[model samples]
Target: MAFVTTFSTSLRSGEGSSICGSRPLSRPSQRKMVRIFMAQEEQLKRAEDRMKKTVETVKSNFNTVRTGRANASMLDRVVVPYYEVDTPLNQLASISIPSSTTIQIDPYDKSVLGDIERSLMEADLGMNPNSDGSVIRLIVPPLTQERRKEFVKSVKAIAEHGRVAVRNIRRDAIDKYKKAEKDGDMSKDESKTNQDLAQKLTDKYVKTIDGLASEKEKDILKV
Candidate 1:
């Protein structure tokens, strides 16, 4: 009988198929579905990890606040207004740590060297640039009491922005979870479970962000 054959196949399929033979799937079909599900789960996981890494990058950028050190991160987002185009300082020059308190920038284009210096000053990272016609030298000055407070505030703002980005990713994941539910790919209970898992993912990212920020804050506070 067809029903008997269908039941036999369903039993051999190991329970990934739909209940009552409504959408009976063979073992190979179930494995394929599992692979698809795992791929999607891995994609979401990678996205969440990216969010966390972004938070760390932002924190690193803020750590460029430098209590008393010359770090390249401080200039990461500083745009050099070159040839009417905004360019990253690193692209214009080579950044190197000559000393704990000195960062050297050797520009490929001597003409744009001035532009890079100007950009650094404009960024208000509080460093004075010294140029030797070929390489620009930045002397990392000690942080003043008032300036340290301002730097702390700036780092906190960066962390808050990271938190916002992580939350946005969480929202996007929730949307995807809902879409999966609507497509009938996931049952209501499974949808709820995935939603909870997504929230856990968000929380984990947020926690990582917080921990990274805290460590960077300590670095910035070191006198």
Candidate 2:
């Protein structure tokens, strides 16, 4: 009888906690809440990591696209031949911008200057490369109106790829959340909340990609 009375008193105290701005939960229920929170955190972390990578890829792709000014990053995608093996152009030569319109390439080994020049022309970057057996100069021409429009299209495509990557991550996270709910780890309401959080993450990254595209387009279109 004494043990029963003690247990009843504990329940009464817990019930009154809500009036004091707190509520006591059973040990099993507390564990369940913690487990659900951890699962949601894991999903959010995965989504964030995936979205960050996508954003970086978009930035890299933008660098590969040329702007009006001479940029070393324009040569980021150029491949050069080093001893019959394909290599990045930067490895074979030191690149610098001596002027706004010219990219100067000084080969560490003089023999590769010709090969590097030929590669630049073939890359179709629309720049003429001139070499005098020592240093090579690439003159970046002003973009024609038509060329600028084409570049805008290319940047939009790259941004779209980033958005798709982020959306795929959101889809995977939501699927995992739903599966956990089905397996009885959380309630339907909890699963829905987690899914909403993942969707918000997706939306945020998509907006960032759109902003990147807008800025790049503006840069390309600006005279």
Top candidate by TM-score: 2
**Model 2, span 1-223: residue lDDT tens:** 3433454455555542232366676656654555566656777787899899999999999988888989999999899888899999998889999999999999898978888988998889999888887999999999999999999999999999899899999999999989989988867987898899898999999999999999999988889
Candidate 1 Cα outliers beyond 4 Å, as residue runs: 1-43
Return the clash pairs for model 2, or none: none
**Candidate 1, residues 92-202: lDDT per residue as tens digits?**
888899899898999888889888888878888777888888898888888777777777787788878888888888788778878887987666776777678778888
> Would you list the C-alpha lDDT of every candidate in the order shown?
0.76, 0.85
lDDT for position 83 in model 1: 89
Model 2 TM-score, all chains together: 0.82
Candidate 2 runs further than 4 Å off: 1-36
TM-score of each: 0.78, 0.82
